[model samples]
Target: MKFYKHAANGFKIVLERKITMHTTEETVVSFRRVSKIFNKKIMALQNFDLEVKDGEFISFLGPSGCGKSTALRMVAGLEKASEGEVQVFNEQPKEVISNTNDVAFVFQDANLLPWRNVLDNVVLPLELRGENKQESRDKAIDVLEKVGLKGHLKSYPRQLSGGMKMRVSIARALAAKPKMLLMDEPFGALDEMTRQTLQMDLLHIWEREKTTILFVTHNVYEAALLSSRIAVMTAGPGRLSALIDVDLPRPRELSIRTSNEFMKYVETASNHLENGSIGRELG
Candidate 1:
């Protein structure tokens, strides 16, 4: 899928989706008027319409109750949309999810088994899919190296640091080679330094694999740092309030956070975040 390319000297945002982009921009995930309510009164989301085109990195950014995580869960087929349709691969969420290697989710906690070593944990998805053990193990080994955990294949969850475990979690998610990856604040629990490292690592994986990523996070800076676009939501009946394009040049280094252009992007996202809208439609 193609993104609206931006010029460096401008602050304006324009998304020109052509008729041809419809063919080229394959939608990996979509939510149409989707709402989630708990206890039949607590409204987590209302009329949320979002479409993730193939290979796009979009982050859902909002306050705690604005349903960012809820949206992400819908994509993973873990939570049904209470009011509308949620699709993955142009089919119902569960339909696509029932098939192996279509979608993968990375949660906040690295839920790697304390007993399984890194190799086994990463290969678990394949094992469940009935893939040959030797082949899955070989694939998992290569993927782990890409995640910088090749050296820790024998280490258990308890034996590794927080970031290493998260890397393993990512490696596991990538094992099945899912077309779309849903992440719910996967690095939220880590320290700033560790989180930053994972952020860069994730970008590398995304670029190399061309996986469609729908990331849910509250950290504005993190969202700005990683996404092609950031969807800002409003509460009191959650809805998409803004879709802010990240126009920064990629192969992005951490030091780019200090640039004037980067600061401007942060300011724009922060403004939309604080006010909840910037005249952008949910479409």
Candidate 2:
């Protein structure tokens, strides 16, 4: 495997090429020559390969129809690849979903129940598993605090700002203390300022939690900001286009976004995205 390592600020990230099938045992998640087709007419993914380490933050970036969400859904066990396999913690995603409590997903919308308070929303997953209410409540509160929502534990989703609602959603995901986080444009609905703020906050939480995260976004800047490695995808019939290691220093504040190095990476990835159609067809 080819490994790329870089240190910025205090954060260090390593990105490695997908391991061969014989070496799957060493990876936390592996997508082996995977493909997905819809209606036998529309191909959503094609010969894709990906491997994620135990605690890395990675992003899948492309345009709206690029099948980024499909890739994530497959990993979440919500969809199955038409060809090849997807393994989580060396087990199939379906197996992981049935037997383990090691993955969580944060969707674009908060998806919080209007009837549930912040604490209750955060504890719902644990509650479903028969965990004690009081214990789960305490765990929920701790994660809420981590997400900067401690004082708003009793607040309803309607009473919160879009950003705050997203925080509640994040708190709920973290409450599970999952080994991996699957985020599908989790901040897409927020305004620019709110999105940027939450992006920073997410980095802080990811740094502390050391959770392996697979984030999907169309925003080049957002992906560059939060990912240790950005995996650019081709247009529908999506395939890995480029796997770029983000070398910007971490505790990455907004200033890094303006730096020449940052722009270089973004521009390169943007070019790949722009040319995705041609690339996919040629491949």
Candidate 3:
């Protein structure tokens, strides 16, 4: 167990040890004084700093334009910081992403192939990596089953529900057996009932796989339900406003979300975003 502190403007940050059994005690993602700008005028991020520990689940909780996705992109090497640095496994994001098997990024939408079956979609990454067709098929089947899509491997994207498609997306990510998973509001589009259901399913997947996850979501309850720590950010030149430790017991069931203790953590995180971003954004 280790305590890591990050100093940044307008907020104090402390990364509590994740209560998970991890093989390594290394930092998975580190953002050092990172800033990102677009078109030289729009500032997507400003002096952002975060440290993601191994096997930890982190949620970037903020508004729609708070650079939550931008931060996630930086980790995946989809976007680069204008200043400072973002290191994945203490290596460049380009290096990690180039390896293909080191990281997987899941977007807001399922982004599944309409023409392909569920198993085919999940095996696409492995095929791209030049694995044997039969071997890839086996890996895809295993991941789909792990994600509760065992009976639907032959189903196409159009045949599945909103939640099911997202499940396929996750299954695809897992098929490659990546070391880290980066999710940007993967369940944000689902209906409330579906969202809650998937949240619980996702928690189960996280526990079973034990991969490092950097999830970006604005929902207070979702962050509280899923993350070990929530990094609250302010909008318009987004920056870390607070890093709140959840400190809740894990192997958690969806029932925990209804508990008073759970709501208390939700309220605390909600207040931090409220005081840091919502309160000022309205002005």
Candidate 4:
């Protein structure tokens, strides 16, 4: 195992060796002195610096308008940074998007086509790239089953419940066999019970697939339950306030959330956000 360190704003950031069995090479996504401004007046991000390790499950936890989504969008190449650079796999974010099929995105909404069946929705990415219809269909079916949607392949998005639709979205993202998955509050709209169920399902999929995930969420418990590490952001002009390593044991079951150890990490993360320590630390 190899260790890497990043120096930003005079702070030394060190990443621990991953304990997973998966051998995928460690890829670091970093924001180097990155900042974003709208109309030259409003600052969305100010000198933001963060590093995400390959195959690691991490979350961006902050209040709305904290630039959590903006950071992800910058990585997705959907938005441009006004200053500094955003790198993925050590290449520019745009280069990563255009030159390789290494990333996939899941938004707050399912964004499934209402007219398409679950299988077709999952196959859409492959189809767009002109893969064989028969082969793509086979792959999509496999991924749908992986997401626990095997019985719903023929069902349309309109016919499925909110949770099911999100499953379809996740299946579609996985169909491409992406190295990194970016999720923006994918379960935020569901009921609490449904949200917890999906969270468990997501963790299962992450473990099985071994894909690096950058999940954005406002819920502290959800972040604690899902992320191996949580990066808390400040209120505005967002920057990394704190990067808390979650020492929770893996193959985590639902009961784990109620354990004292789990709540301790959650409370620590909450305190960082509540006391505005994140901003102060960055400053």
Check candidate 3 and list the clashing pairs. Answer: none
Better by lDDT, candidate 4 or 1: 4
- TM-score for each candidate, following the candidate numbering: 0.91, 0.89, 0.91, 0.91
Candidate 3 C-alpha lDDT tens digits along 41-119: 9999988878888888889999889899999999999999999999998899998899759899889899999999999
Model 2: what TM-score?
A: 0.89
Residue 87, candidate 3: Cα error in Å is 0.4
C-alpha RMSD of each candidate structure in angstroms:
3.6, 5.0, 4.5, 4.4
| Candidate 2 runs further than 4 Å off | 1-26, 276-283
Per-residue lDDT of candidate 2, residues 164-256 (tens digit): 999999988888789899999999989999998899999998878778899999999888888878888887878887677776776789888
The C-alpha local distance difference test score for the whole of candidate 2 amounts to 0.83
lDDT of 4 at 250: 83
2 versus 3: better lDDT goes to: 3
- Candidate 1 residues 1-283, lDDT tens each? 4233232445544332322211247777778888899889999999887777788888898888888888888888889888999988888888888875889999998899988999999999899989999999999999999998888999999999999999999999998888888889999999999999999999888878888888999888899899888888886477877766777787788998999988888887676678644233322
- The local distance difference test score of each candidate is 0.82, 0.83, 0.84, 0.83
Tell me the deviation in Å of residue 165 in model 3.
Answer: 0.6
User: Least accurate stretch of 10 residues (summed lDDT) in model 2?
Assistant: 6-15
- Which is the winner by TM-score between candidate 1 and candidate 4? 1
**Model 3 ranges with Cα > 4 A deviation:** 1-24, 277-283
